[model samples]
Target: MTTSFAQVMIFLGLGIGIIILLTAVFRVHAFFALLIACFVVGLGVQMPVAAIINVTKQGFGHIMQSLGFIIVLGTTLGVVLEHTGSTKVMATYILKRIGEKHAPLAMSITGFIVGLPIFCDSGYIVLSGLNKSLCRRTGISVVIMSVSLATGLYSVHCLIPPHPGAASAATTIGVDFGRLILVGMAVAVPATLVGYGWARYAGRKFNNEEPGQAPVVDLSLPTPSVLLSFLPVIVPILLIGIKSFIGIDANKPVPDWAGLFMVVGDPVIALAIGIIMALLAVRSWKKSTVSNLLQEAVEKAGGILVIIGAGGAFGAILAATQVGQHVSKVVNLQALGIFFPFLLTAVLKTAQGSSTVAIITAASIVQPLLPALGLDSEMGKLLAVLSMGGGSMMLSHANDAYFWVIARFSGLDMRPMLQVYTVASLFMGLITLLMVFILSLFLL
Candidate 1:
């Protein structure tokens, strides 16, 4: 019944390899791929067939229970923002305040803030016009404009919750969502800057290709005010942060008013409140329009939800093998600490090119290893979640859909895209990892 460390590692490698080969090479759907991986690892570890089946179902359901509604609520909020033109309103407002001279910086900031509520691909598409218009008007290189915006969005997408990767990781590792969000935002700020800085510097080295024509903005539609544009995003974060802070000092006497914040600040309730705020910006209250929009958000979240569930199943099987205990006894992974997750995730991200898959898979693998690696502490787990996020952003190339999104949207060719944005992603990932490592030293 005792599986050696080498055997555990071999089975683990085979399971992960199966995932990469099927997903990256054969182009199999991730949900099926992950399910197959769970079976492979389960069989390799000599687990009972019935146990494996039950574990898979349990793992999948657990992830769904934790993240399903939050993901849908967050996705719905994003859909509302997109349909109501609130994203553009926020982007335009920033562009005007920052002016054309600092257009790249303005675009980066816009992407960072807007990206909090939406996926990176959609965020880029929605704002690509503004990026192009800024480039044309300011005569900034399209390379700089595109990378700045892309990196800014990329920065937050990898690390933050309600964004799938980080959210799933938090659920797997049992970290506080509020703390993860606050810490994730802290790490994201520097990563965003590194992307911005790299874009401005390396973007000039490439030929300053003229950006494509800006997309026509629909001027007739009434948009949300800038202040109103910010509320939905900011309010949930504040509520979550306040609740987290109160809980941090459990010894302190709790306040009477804190009870209300606790309810509103729960991640699910917070995001639901956000959805209500997002609805306020909707110009049309028609039953059809609202129904269609909600449907769209659900549709968007559906694929993500399943993939995350599969990832959870995979991790459960991996954990069932007692691999973490074996590895902990055999090696000094504790010394490696945060870097283990960072490297594993970077490899997965580079291999498969889906940050969500990369982070979710990596977190599943790492979750079992946490106690052995001396990362079972609360802060250690938070940094681990972040470190996986750091890895998920590196080396975006042809395999990455987001890379192509930036490529086609900015009209940048492959060579330039690799040189500018791809390289920037590597730098961004490194800087983010380094930041996480330093935080581990202090906090862990």
Candidate 2:
């Protein structure tokens, strides 16, 4: 049965509305809400009952299979760094060199680099304490540092590879992964700078001081060296970037030496290696302290893993409906040019509050229309991935986990969160879209 465009819109709207209602209004957990949304969309699209079940299972399993271990390893690495004071060491080193006046920029750069390997939530958690310390020491507004870091983390999280969102989008759209990396980096730097600019402006305008006393970091503890502190975050990015350069493909023969980099460069393995390095870097701590930290890391990772799985399931169900194919047939998306992908992804991200889901679903929708949209070329495909990524950054509000991570960790009230972090994301996303549009003009 052919689903009409209007019908598809209804199904899509119902699905997204239910998710927003459940998560934002009724206060349901995102995991349950996303699962419910999958069923709603499936049923609304009139998918068979049996098919819905299978699709849900396949979607959940596929996402978990691809990303579960990577997420866990990344979280473990984050936990190890957070507990071991490595995050603080790195923050302090950067601040000391740059001076306190540029604390926001320093934190932003730190977030940009660290977020390459770590999830934004985990990165924020790992650095929030250090953010507070920097704020206290420098009298810089915590709000400024918080938004700057959030923006930095988010810029790469949405744009760059080794981040599951961008990588997954690249794979889904059949773009060359290595090229996506280069394009994403080019886009991310400008997006991050836009974020930095907003954070600086917002920091001055909204002066809501942190309410409570800052947590005292122990100065006497034997912290890891700055170089050691960096290895967990840096090594994986370098290896992965190198692997992208090597260009592995099933059709071509790869060198034996390249094999080692491939093994180490896989996001899961690279982060796992990071975890091992993180553990070693903190080896001097008491055994019980280490044990507690590991346990805590596991506990924190549980919620995020569930949300990711649910998001995957939701995306799967959307794919099953073939809404993108239908939309491609109905809309003259080519007329809109580069803005088409960006607008579509922005709507998806704003509705669902998961950038990874937004990227995956948008890429799927855009893939079928690539030729029609003049995005069938190599460079065009990269731009499409980036345009979608830029859109994914729009309006990260109550529903986004990263939003809460920024709000809770940085101790901002709801009003401030909306004003600072949420608005900044919207601005940053627009800036990124502008950059993508300009790039498309040249590349296309």
Best by TM-score: 1
Model 2 bad stretches (over 4 Å):
161-183, 206-221, 248-252, 285-291, 351-382, 398-419, 442-444
- Give the local distance difference test score of model 2: 0.78
Local distance difference test scores for all models: 0.90, 0.78
Backbone clashes in candidate 2 total 0
How far in Å is the alpha carbon of 136 misplaced in model 2? 4.1
Off by over 4 Å in 1: 213-221, 251-253
* Cα lDDT of model 1 by residue, 239-318, tens digit: 98888988887688778979998889988999999888888865657787789889999999998999999999998888
- Assess every candidate by TM-score: 0.97, 0.85
| List of clashing residue pairs for candidate 1 | none
**CA shift of 418, model 2, Å:** 4.1
lDDT of 2 by residue, 1-444 (tens): 567788877987887778667766677887888788888888887898888889888877876787677667766787777667787777778878888889999999888877776678877877777788778888877788888988988998998765666766776566765566666777889888888888888777666578233345553347889999899877776666677677645577778889898778776777778888887885466777778877887787677668667766777787777776776787786788788889988988897687876776577567766777878887788888889999999979987878877877788878878887888889889988999888877878
